[model samples]
Target: MGEVEIRPPRPEEYAVAGEVTVLAYQADGHLADGVGYDATLRDVARRVEAAEVLVAVDRAGDVVGTVTIVQPGSEYAEISRPGELEFRMLAVAPSARGRGIGDALVGAVFDRARALGLRRVVLSSLDRMHSAHRLYERLGFARLAERDWRPFPHVMLIAYQIDV
Candidate 1:
């Protein structure tokens, strides 16, 4: 219930961010299938090295959320095209949900996109993440159904875009 800071995770905070991401996903039943996605969620270091990894920290300086922003041609980018910025792996701590941390982190992404002179920002979310979809809609993102994709069998990823 205090001010939350959105910034890049420090070297020592990478592991903390990774743990928070994993915990958030597991708490939301996103990892219920015992799939290999848990490892991906916990690989904050890899994401940090490959893209910009942003973390939301509480007033006490505890990392409560994380998101990875990928540039147009970054290896982590999936559905983004030229002139668009893409973000992925957005996760907020279970205890910190509904505290505006996710919104703040996403706002940071939009800020970064504008700062880079990008025309749009794009992201993909699991179909079942209704709360996140609501947040994206509230932030002015519109679903791009034609761009929706399935990276794995039986797993559909929905795409959303917002012109910045």
Candidate 2:
């Protein structure tokens, strides 16, 4: 693996980030329900209009991972309250799995939360994403089972939180 930088993506890289996010989720079988969530996953530009979009870029300057950091009242925030930050759409390219890019990207979220003077960060993930659950646990996120929700009939999103 090459050196990876976790930072806000350039405007020109939005499409690449969106595609990487969509493809990553697809490869992980998170898109099998045919609920049209891919449209949201592919809208990096839209997400950037409301929240911070961070990308993991390799030494070659290719975006291999992406995540959205949502402020408490932002359009992408679903389970966060005042003084709490939320993250959404975490995705690492299939080819870049196991290279720690996801960790770096999520670490950047913590950094952003601290920068914003927030102490708590929350996120929702697909229940079937066992590997992601492990990563969240390793990063100190505890399961927020009471906050689990279903945005659609075919999808149930489990919640997690960590205090930074």
Candidate 3:
């Protein structure tokens, strides 16, 4: 880990959303399942004004990871608890995977979550990604439930929640 700095996403950093989305979710042949990375990036852009986004920048100031913190609303109606914050999109570039960039991005969320006095943080992750599941567990997130989700062929939708 070479000085990973996690900070709030700025207006200019929005330009990296699409590229990051593609790297985070796309290029995985098994998980493609007809989902559109472009649409996800657009949603991220649209929610930027209301959502809390954290980006991981290396010592050189290049973004290597990102995590979006979404609050409850009609936008996040799936979340039953209004006081909960969702760790929606968490991603670390392939090259930065083992360097603690993901941990830094997630830590930024926890820092903000504590300041806001949030009750819990929730997230949905695909079950196929076992390593990611381990990472979330290592961060103290426990499995809440698993269900079938939309936009993909995967039937296992593991949801996790962590109390603040």
On residues 72-146, what C-alpha lDDT tens digit does candidate 1 reach at each position?
788899999999999999999999898899999999999999999999999999898888899999999999999
lDDT of candidate 3 over 28-117, digit per residue (tens): 432365655456653556657667777787888787788778777736434536777787768776766788777777777777778888
User: Candidate 1 has what TM-score?
Assistant: 0.96
Q: Please, what is the whole-model Cα lDDT of each candidate in the order they appear?
A: 0.91, 0.92, 0.71
Q: How many backbone collisions does model 3 have?
A: 0
User: Which regions in candidate 2 have their CA more than 4 angstroms from the true location?
Assistant: none
Q: What local lDDT does model 3 show for residue 16?
A: 78
Which residue pairs clash in candidate 1?
A: none
Cα RMSD of all models vs. native, in order, equals: 1.4, 1.3, 2.5
**Pairs of colliding residues, candidate 3:** none
Estimated TM-score for each candidate: 0.96, 0.96, 0.84
- By lDDT, the best candidate is 2
Compared with the true structure, what per-residue lDDT tens digits does model 2 show for residues 18-120? 9999999889888889888899999999999999999999998899999999987778899998999999999999998998998898888998999999999
The C-alpha stretches of model 1 lying farther than 4 A from their native spots are: none
